[model samples]
Target: MQVQFGVLGPVVAWDGAGDAIALKGPRHRAVLARLIIARRRVVPVFRLVEDLWTDPPADAVGAVRTFVAALRRALEPERPPRAPARLLLTEGPGYALRAEPGAVDAWRFEQAVAATATLPPKEVFARLEEALGWWRGPAYAEFADQPWVRAERSRLAELRLHAVERQAEARLGLGLAAEAVPDLDAHVAEHPWREDAWRLLALALYRTGRQGDALAVLRRARTLLVEQLGVDPGPGLRGLEADILGHAAHLAPAPGPGGAAGRVWAQTAAAYDRTVPSGARVRLESTVGLLRNLAVTGGSGLQAARRHRVAAVAAAEELGDAELTARVIGVYDVPAIWTRVDDPEQAAQVVAAAERTLTALPPGGHEAARARLLATIALESRGPLPQARRAGRTPSARGPQAARQAEEIARRLDDAALLAFALNAVFMQTFHRAGLAPRRDEIGVELVALSARHGLATSEVLGHLIRLQARSALADFPGADHHATAADRLAERHELPLVGVFTQWYAALRTAATGPAAAAEAEAAYRNAAARLDGAGMPGLEHGLLPLALLCLRVQHAQPAQAEEHTDWGPYEPWARPLALLAQDRRSEAAAALRKVPDPPHDLLFEALWCLTAQAAIAVGDRQTMERAYIQLTPAAAELAGAGSGLLTLGPVSKHLSDLATALRRPR
Candidate 1:
């Protein structure tokens, strides 16, 4: 059976009989459009409800279901015997389209262009030409007045232009200069002000040895530029024109210093080494400049790798010392991996150089320098224990240990800000390992006080403080409120995305102590936090506190899907599975899942608490299990109680906990 989907150009379709299938009504078209693009994937009913009704009247869900049914019927007017679902099928919690790959015209266009990348120049040109020929006019022209369709049409148009540009480049590279010239000229006539197209045209003309024509083209471009925007051609365009006139050899683009985009890449690398923070305005500006430069000098494959190495080394040099340079290079490794440009040999060599530099440092001569060296080593090695051990040692027992000596020097030098920064890094390592919470808290508080005194608003410090406070409250430690309030105020002032997450966790804990209404409030807060987090591009893997928040909120809300979506237990898959199963009310499955969680390290309080909570929830008849959970959580409960929330009543695992317990107690 034949069915066509079109998002690019006019809305058109044909049925199995090859008869025109007309789609009428704006909203109906929109519903179909969304389903087609999100093809095969089940877009949740709630999301569709939101789309169809901006201020959905009561029965929004029902209205959405009606729309789905209507769309399905429209697509399959004459359902054949034993035929598969024509357009849509009900899947878990939502609907999915059943269209085959390339059944959609939009998908066909993309496939054609992607195939062109591997084909010969003539073939590439032909494929793109055919793909472009599919467009009958402005995309979804009948629905152009609709906001979503308009935006989608704009995106498709951009894609078409990109395909054209790439095809033109291939044609020119194949020495088909005269062949590309007319099409490029037509493109220029349509988009006369686009400098890249003009540049391509000029290059194509020059390549055919039409030097005079190329110069004339540049002259026309300059005139157009002056008339349109009252500006001369940019440096690159002007340089190209000069080259053509002088008959000079074409210049090869040079790899940037350290392979960074532009001058600022080198500058930012230097600044990073000099103790400047990551998100500073100066560093960001430099990063932007470097990116712009890199775009201008396009390199592929091995050339790209060489350019990145150059950039890394330049950054290392700007950082000043050998260790700092190595650390800067290590930072480059993350992007290199994503871009598939990582060089293990180069990385190892840099690390070796850093170690040598550290080894060669004179005893007790420079405390700050020594600390910097150690910090760089710690960062490069990715071994926190080794770093902690190294940091624990003094440069000389009597003369000056690096950490202590560095602290003293910071005090004497009136550099509290730097002192705070140094201490924060140390705290990060300590907090990650077992049995270091007290020390972590002390150092974190000190850092916060120092930062506050120095008029600093550090998100890093605030985030650490929030985690420490939550831990302290859980462990029943002192000063939880002070830390919690401090974290809350800082997060509110900055509109920090993570703060909402922590706030929800705090609310859940409070609710469990108080009552169901409080628990419901916590659930609402968690939902709000999740919505806010949806678009924010926080690091996917390094969400240290978010998992903890999700665990707490899951108990409060009893929503398994929400819990699963946020749980990121790196390498602890077995442990996470039980928690997920339990949250979903699969009692026996959840209990079975728990055997996978390895025994916790003795000092890891939170892990123990979670285990106890799980065990108690799974074995309701066993008073011993509940008692043990109470015993483990008592200290944490007391600490939170002391922080002035009366809800800190600890015992028979509250309503959320009781639900799990009840589920577990039911007949198998």
Candidate 2:
């Protein structure tokens, strides 16, 4: 007869047919519970004697043996007389209860919780929810008062708390931070000393945009720790507080539906695998090729997309089709950064791969594949053009040539997606030069129309985003806000969470531009946006962006600039350092530094730096540098500074041009 033990709630046993096994009395149940807690290990008769009674009775040993016999008969009613008991076996000193898998609820619950560790957030949450459901009340509930069960009960309770906290973490990972708040609130209330619980609750509140409430939760946690535990909160809580204060980007949920999209891709991949005919290499190659493009724009993690790229490239090469190989290679996995160069090594590899694939294909016939390769090459190689130009070197036209060719081919092919991609490449190449807002606005219009017509979610988001930047740079806040609203709505609807980061930062920049009164609020917004970026784990995206924003605000609003606040200015260091020095009243040093600062690189950052330089030169009475900055910034005078990224802005360029006109005695 099969038997299932239940110690998670009450110390009870049920037979194979779901009938209750009579446990006789409290002492009888205690003996069985003691054996179960020993985990199938032999418990000496003497130990059982001590466990059953605080003071051993004269026939305590005999009483234990009788109880064990009763348990064996009840647990295995079909056992023949004198037959060795299977469920309860007699050892040399005492006995052991043999429990099989799923026979013990407590053991099964523990196993389920352990299995959730490697799973992604959604699966982890699901598995943990199921595991936690196995707990009826508590471990060994009816045996709760027994001295032998005390330690085990406490351990099980702690495990339950851990499971609760992990589930909350999974919720946060799934972008359900608001949903995690109430449970975490109840959890921390129940377990006041659990710092992790308090931290999670605070984080949830922060994600929901309740900054004050989040900080209050942390404060309450600190008070509890100091009052109850007589110690400070641990490093995790402290670090989280600092991260929250700074608006660290890592705290934000992933920008897109990476987890959800991964799940969808997994299902689609399985379907393809199931339908593919066995030994059909060409079909397999075709399947891989189709999946490769999906993975690139699937909003999944980079590693997953890279895996698909590798597999697709390998399959394409195996088929020995040059056009197919080039197409596969052309669909790069890395997300493009428009504001600045981030990953040079990966970009270089992509350019080299595309070039080599293009060389392998017959030049004339593979127009679609060739266009894709050209666009990818342009995107990867466009970064250094501005720097080369700044060094008085005639910049290579290869990148621009590729972007033009890709766009031309895409237009002829009548493929909207292809044209959108090629236009994106053209945008990347042209964005390196300053004073191109009008041109960028034109591209934005076409991308929006094309992507909307094709129902391409990602490309449509990109379109609205580009329009937002161009509008902001043109000093059209209402137009910028319109596109920002559109982009944000699309982002949420399509699971592109990262779009909010840019929109939020622009909100801050707009706030700062409202004048000096809004500086503090704007600063907080920037820090929060930075935190979101950090949470997204894309470091280069936020690099120097914050400092530049702060500096722009300070200089524009005539606020006192603190040089020490910007310890790391990243790529803007050379251009921004002198301005910071000049702000500190170091005229000679500022002028010398200004002289060393070369003609500004023509990139997204160019107009902002030029305006900053003009401000610093005005302060130092350096007409030579002022005139230089004036000439460079003149064409962009009608534009807004640093608004090309749809992220940050430094007010209008005309404002800086006005300052230069008054200082250098130059007519504007």
Candidate 3:
């Protein structure tokens, strides 16, 4: 059987079947309520006696004992004569209530509100609404005049109010400012001292085009604070007031779902579904390409994408149209930088399709289409399949060969988009190795110049993102931040929401690198970024990316890295596990583990893995691994380790290299 308690309204208890436990009299109810407010802590019998009454009779202690007995009988009706109470237990000199999680409505309500910090607007609003529903009325309403319950009651009331404000904040985030206005108006009117509520009400009014009303609300707030509280309005309220007067551009509502580009793609997909036939070979082929690109970048479901890919490839093959096949294969959407191919099986299918088309075309003909297919092969082949890795299959040079052929053809064609495409393929092949930031930097430069000249918005965003990663790796904070800003602006303009995702990650990385003063803030920032990434539905890009970054941050701060280590880091587990072991002070275990791990793979995360290894080696005093890591990391000695991921870093590579040298008895 189960039991539940509620003090959100009058003190009450319900058994497993929802029948209210008859807490006999006022004194019995008071005792039960006091015990509930103890929050599982032991409440001394003497303290309860003083709180229950101002005056005592000769048998007052006996009276207290009788009240406890009655309460136990009501709360635990099934207890045998000799059995002790399960929910309420007597300990030492007091009694404690052992309610489970969610048994108490007040506790459950608080937890729900606390969890909304990192959620998206829609989720935040839903959760906050659920939390507020737990409040039946004033907390401990039956004991409003009692001094004993005063503090707890006040605390819960304030928490409920704060939840209301948080919900309104979420509403504003969801662009529902108009809907938020009514409740906020009531909230501020009833609690005029709450500047946050006032600010939200004003902002909501302003968003709803009531600028004069918004300004008036702020003015009223200022007057209330100055006259009653004897302080000017806080920074937030004052700042909002100033922004309203100036009509700041940022105050406008955010762009609707997916911005302009997303709406267009959605409309197009809908129109195609409504009117286009599967037998329209050419149109279907183009639609399939667009769907595949969306699947990679985001805004498309995986099963649907796979279905489209299969159907389109089959249709093109059945028709024996090489051009349509090439179109389908060549148009795989290039995702944001650092987004490795997650569905390698799908990639292999595309490669097979391209090869079949290549065989159909004459050796010297279809150069443009051939170049695109070759670049696709190069990009897709860069990340080896998990099954191949498990089988210990050595990588072939096919990726590089295809990339080179693509680049040669693109250069001959004198097409900027084609050249940029080939360069991206080359980037995929080369970027996985450690100490290759300089090469990557050169590619980034060419990408930016060429893409900007041709006004390739997607490519331009990609260029800035690549440059941001390279610059961060090369220890140029200013350059990295500059590119990050540019990438953010370009992504917003182009409706590339995922681009902003990476840029936000870069901001967190910068915060984490700012040292101990920002450690807590940095952790919060990383958590929020991870939440946003998850919410965006880009799981492939999110997997292990933030966890690796967090591990790097914790390692630098000399904090406990055990929590981060326990996360399911997928392929990066080998690099992160040893560091976590060292963090727990298991030095010999860390050293042995490091010895068993393979050399870090040459991929986008190569530098990150090596740098993590370098940290573990330093801690475990594994001089040999130190020397190996040193050799790989020394080339980019001035750079910050792991910045290529745009999420987190393990301080500077130079710092680790210097330490490795010192340990190795060599000069820096």
On TM-score, the candidate that comes out on top is 3
Better of 1 and 2 by lDDT: 2
Q: What TM-score would each prediction reach against the true structure?
A: 0.44, 0.58, 0.60
Superposed model 3: Cα runs more than 4 Å off:
1-277, 292-307, 386-396, 563-565
Q: List model 1 lDDT by residue over 215-235, tens digit each.
A: 889889999999989998988
lDDT of 3 by residue, 1-668 (tens): 77999899988999997778899888888998899898899999889899999987778778988999888888889899979889888899988889987899999988898899889878999998877977788998889999999999999999999999999998877777766878999999999999999999998878766788899999999999999989999999989999999999888766765334433443454456447775677676676766755654553454467657767776778887788788776765464366367577776666667767888876677888999888877777756654334446533467778888999999999988888889888877775456777788888899999999999878888888888888887778799999998988887776677776788888898898889899889988998888877646555567877677777777777776754434777678889888777777778888889998788867766777887887788778888898899888877777788777667788887887887888788976
Reference-based TM-score, model 2: 0.58
Ranking by lDDT: 3, 2, 1
User: Residue 250, candidate 2: how far off, in angstroms?
Assistant: 38
lDDT of 2 at 96: 88
Off by over 4 Å in 2: 1-268, 271-300, 303-321, 332-337, 385-396
